[model samples]
Target chain A: AQSVTQPDIHITVSEGASLELRCNYSYGATPYLFWYVQSPGQGLQLLLKYFSGDTLVQGIKGFEAEFKRSQSSFNLRKPSVHWSDAAEYFCAVVASGTASKLTFGTGTRLQVTL
Target chain B: DTAVSQTPKYLVTQMGNDKSIKCEQNLGHDTMYWYKQDSKKFLKIMFSYNNKELIINETVPNRFSPKSPDKAHLNLHINSLELGDSAVYFCASSPFDRNTEAFFGQGTRLTVV
Candidate 1:
């Protein structure tokens, strides 16, 4: 079945440290990958999405993700982590069709330390 | 603002009860969706409606019903809710198809005790 996997369940990074959250997906066609950030007591916000064109896509809040077709991976990265950036990150993929229903990963929680 | 919005940000109810969550989007979107965020904060699409028609329905229980009166409105009605139903229900909207970035609402935290 089609699915999205975020191998890292939980990650911790210092306020100024670089951060990376990895994601892999299983799909048959050209997948439409997306990264979403969920702050505490809030809804999921779109960080970035990859539909076509360049493999590296830039997103809001100084975040970016690269979609690698060979690896079937779309990893989210940040140059410097902030205390406020500590939140749950999810990677999702839309099925190939008009439905385009999104399949989300279990999620990866990032903890920012001092 | 041209954004998706949901009402009753917080709901606290008991099991075996019935409740409804309402959603609205003024983004001139043609599709509206209902998603559930579990306790562990995993978001999944529950249902989708396009042009007031049900397009995609996941393997959700029949107790949970979604009604789209119009293109801009879709409401979820849950009957005889169970303890496992306790989670955050989110409402989102997209302009046309699956490739579009969906706009989300603040979410309705439904608590079943």
Candidate 2:
């Protein structure tokens, strides 16, 4: 079974400050990774995804994530976050051969302080 | 136009009542899924259907039934709802390929009192 672990339950970053959300996954082989954001009372939106080829994947709203095979991590990063970036971010993984099943981590609540 | 849409954005009902939530996707994706998001912001997959065929069924209660009449529609029906069943349900669809990303609906919030 593939599982995602987000160590930080809550993260607070000031506006214009850089941010990084850690995500670790447990999977036997190379897996498909994704980052999703959910604003309050809204559904989850795809931030980015990593399947093959490039180790660094860029997403909407100037967000990006790098897939590290050695560490089994796909951490989301943004150079400068805005106040509207505050939301719940989830890290998800789909094991090889399981295209429809997505295992998500307990979301990390981002708080952008001005 | 909404690529994925779920009816009754907000549903409030008492315990022991039966209710249903309908979902439709116009993306023409072959796979559709039902995901539950708890109050604590944890998401879990409940059911998935591909081309009107059931593919993934999680460890959900038997009271929760999902029906896919066609490739573009997947409806979830809950029987004898409990307080524990109160949560936000999201409908999502994606292409059959592994590299594709799933598009999610706004979600339907269900409250059982």
Candidate 3:
């Protein structure tokens, strides 16, 4: 079974500080990965995705994630986080085959302090 | 225009009452899905429809039924709603074959009293 794990439950960071959110996945073969952000009471918005490509993938809103096959990790990073960047982040992996189901992580809530 | 939209952004009803959440996507995607986000923000796939065909049905209860009138719409109907059913339900759509990124709706918050 394909699964995604986001270790951090919540994180607090000052404005303009660097941010890193950890994500790990378990799958038999190489899997498709994605990062999504959701604001309070809102739906999810796709930040970035990783298929078979360069390990470093850039996403919207000055966000990026690096996929490490050895560690089974896809960690999201940002050099400078703005206060408006505070939101919930989810890491997901698409199940193998044509089923096209997405297995999502528990999500990490980010709190940006001004 | 919204890529995906769900009706009744907020719903509050009593237990045993049946309710339906309607979803539509204008993105011309062939696949639509229903996901449930619990209080703890854990999202789980509930059902998936491709071109109006049921493709992925999770371990959801029989009381929950998903209907896809077409490739652009998928609706979720729940019978005998329980307090446990209270959560945010998200509707999403993606291309049928590639299945990389999925566009999600604003979500419908269901509250069962």
Top model by DockQ, which number? 2
Question: lDDT score, residue B98, model 2?
Answer: 83
Which runs in model 1 stand beyond 4 Å of their true positions? none
Q: Model 3, residue B41: what's the lDDT? A: 90
**Model 2 chain B weakest 10-residue run by lDDT:** B94-103
Score chain B of each candidate by TM-score. Answer: 0.96, 0.99, 0.98
DockQ score for model 3? 0.76
Give Cα distance to truth, residue B29, candidate 2, Å: 0.4
Report the C-alpha lDDT of model 2 over A3-111, residue by residue, as the tens digit: 9999999999999999999999999987899999999999889999999989999999999999999999999999999999999999999856645578899989999
For candidate 3, write residues A3-106 as lDDT tens digits.
89999999999999999999999999988999999999899999999998699999999999999999999999999999999999999999976866899999
C-alpha lDDT values of all predictions? 0.92, 0.94, 0.95
Off by over 4 Å in 2: none
Ranking by DockQ: 2, 3, 1
Per-residue alpha-carbon lDDT of candidate 3 for residues B1-113, written as tens digits (9 for 90 to 100): 99999998999999999999999999999999999999999999999999999999898999999999889999999999999999999999999865468999999999999
Q: What DockQ would candidate 1 receive versus the native complex? A: 0.72
Q: What is the lDDT of residue A65 in candidate 3?
A: 98
I-RMSD for candidate 1: 1.3
